[model samples]
Target: MTCLPLLASASGAAIPLALIIPFVLLLMLIAVMPLMVAKVKHWWEHRYPFVAIGLGLLVVVYYLLRIPGGGETIAHTLEEYFSFICLIGALFTVAGGIHIKVKGSATPVGNIVFLAVGAVLANFIGTTGASMVLIRPWLRMNKIRLGAYHVIFFIFIVSNAGGALTPIGDPPLFLGYLRGVPFFWLIEHVFLIWLLVIGLILAVFFAIDFRAFKKTPSAVQSEIGESDTWRFEGGLNLLFLLVIIGAVFLPAKFFLREIVMLAAAAGSYFSTPRAVHAQNEFNFGPIREVAFLFAGIFMTMMPALGYLEQHGQEFGFKKPAQYYFAAGSLSSVLDNAPTYVNFLELAETTVRAEEPAAFAALGDEKHAAVRLLLERRPLLVIAVSLGAVFFGAMTYIGNGPNFMVKSIAESSGVRMPTFFGYILKYSLPFLLPILALVGWLFL
Candidate 1:
């Protein structure tokens, strides 16, 4: 089996191990980051948007020499990569300009129930769709529902899990479908994990929400004149998201269409500049952090992927179950689309080997594969899908939507935890255990 370009043409294949070693060096460099991050000069700024961009440039430039397909395909993927961050950042920042932070009044228990139900609703509206629609409302609800952890829970479940079963709901699942995983495969296999995560999170949410609700007495009886304090100042960024969605809906496999759409979006943003004293004032720092780190991961992991494809079978990774857990674990931290691609390559390699016997039977050019255990396909699909959506809740920066919610929360005077702070205080303590349960019970 040969290596295929996800963004480029399939012209280049079979990348050598010798070619991938430099990236291994780069990974080693980052592996000791906990030691390096402290030694930096201006830690905060360098830690954020700049760090992401700098790392991205470093990795891409390093790998550009080794990886083939140096034409429009490489150019296209590069454009798509940076453009995704920029556009998403621009829209996020601009959105902050329009809406004022309004508070809500609800018990933590009720808040948890509301969000648990909200995740289910997100599926029909679309995860990204729901993120756009409900984020502000959730923020408003939290305005009055003071000291509630429901926002994070909302991000973990409604913002992420709610989209696990459908490609339309999450970008990663869409990538899987594009790579030949069936659209309905997620629902058939992955929904159980989604439900488990949701159920557990909701249960936790109920405990915390209820506890908080009890501590804070209702202000309903007081002379609070302004009941509807939540105001909605419409921003043009929402319209831009709709356009991006429209552009994405087209089978514009490459960045040509996305580029054109992005160009139009850029034009619209420049033309309709928001007031200086915008609501939250969107920052690129967070998205910058994600872009740079993932770019390094994306480029360097190309080699790791090459090795996996050729040798996954040697390591007794022949079943769909193995692929499921493997892809899921990587997708938990690594960006999900590329993780899906890596596994797809492995699947192709394994299937191609059976071609001789299969060819002897059906004699098809695109050789058929013997299905693994009946549980293999479903289990694999579910693991990847569930991990992509659910584990994102494990960290604030794990998913795009998670940061968006955090930023919105912080702007509204809610002191959301810092990076490691968030993990130690919230994610590592609470979420990991449930995630482990899901891994055991399902994956």
Candidate 2:
């Protein structure tokens, strides 16, 4: 979920430890339920929406009845949730209307090239948009030799890290833009690190894919060697995609942005031919699951966020590396967008407290604190931005696009890793080291 300005006003005494239980339990259930016995898994699949909502309601009720200024917090959170789901649902709907068909099997080299292209495209259309549009074609191209690594690496590159260069690329960066950072500031600062991280991840992906490629039978290799052909359908949806992306810049008043996105989605949905929809196998199931689950996530995490905001400085984070790892660690479980915002606010608070005279010298200009922070402590911003974006790949629920990509892949018959399996198999072994290296070198 994206951050709201109201989050900054969640000022009060610290939240009780017990109040955080629903959030912890929800996360545990999300992680463990899919790995359980078939009966339990089946039960979870059917009942998760109810469970998520029920738990979320517990926290909501507690906040409304017990806490001061709780209603405003919930209202702002629901607002963020609505905007979040609108963008996600619109992208899912619009992208589903456009179908890409790859006629030849994918070679390791070809797959790497395709992923590289996706990384660049993510900066323009956003991770969610790029992931939604490219995932089906990616799956189709590698169907013969597809493995969990394929989807996992796709999540690492295209769905998360690839979207670091621009505000439109990811929700956290976009919120950063809305908060006062310049639109092109991220690319200006993080371009090299972005290239380095993307290059290294691609290299790792290539080595693994090549080994798997060698294991394919000669007949399949020969088929893969065939000339690749591409077909594009529902070209009109490109305009709708642009509309959704453009809507991000709209003022978030009277639901204008969400309305624009919903309108585009509707226009794309009704105007597209049935054959394209059938070919894409587009349905509302993935988006539906995401909406229900995140509704709970956004609500339940309110107290956790409030707790962090109130006492974050006590954690003794005073360096860029600390912010990087701390923010990344939290982003691994919490939604990265809000995680980014919280860490950003933390950085601001730290600077103001540490250097009151310097902060005061900046006067009361709009976003003067952010400007001063940029001038004096640029690396903190860089670290938080990188951490939030990169570590979002650590879990399915870390970022909006991660779960959607997993759901899409699974619906296409790809046997994905469970929540813990994803971390153990991919995030811990492959992604964490690269991120740590980046933090060590750059932050």
In terms of lDDT, which candidate is strongest? 2
Relative to the unseen true structure, what is the C-alpha lDDT of residue 357 in candidate 1, on a scale of 0 to 100? 59
Candidate 2 residue-wise lDDT, 107-195, digit = tens:
88889899999999888777887898889889888988899999999999999999999987887887677667877888999999999
Error of 2 at 49 (Å): 3.0
TM-score each candidate.
Answer: 0.71, 0.86
**Each prediction's RMSD to truth:** 5.5, 3.4
- Candidate 2 accuracy as lDDT: 0.84
lDDT of 1 at 234: 50
The residue-level lDDT of candidate 2 at 27 comes to 70
Candidate 1 lDDT: 0.56
- Candidate 1 residue lDDT tens string, 233-347: 6556557656654554455355554575556556544654454223345444554555666565555555555565556566656655566657656555545556665666566
User: Which window of ten consecutive residues has the lowest lDDT sum in model 1?
Assistant: 365-374
Off by over 4 Å in 2: 1-14, 175-182, 214-219, 225-228, 333-335, 357-375, 395-397, 400-425
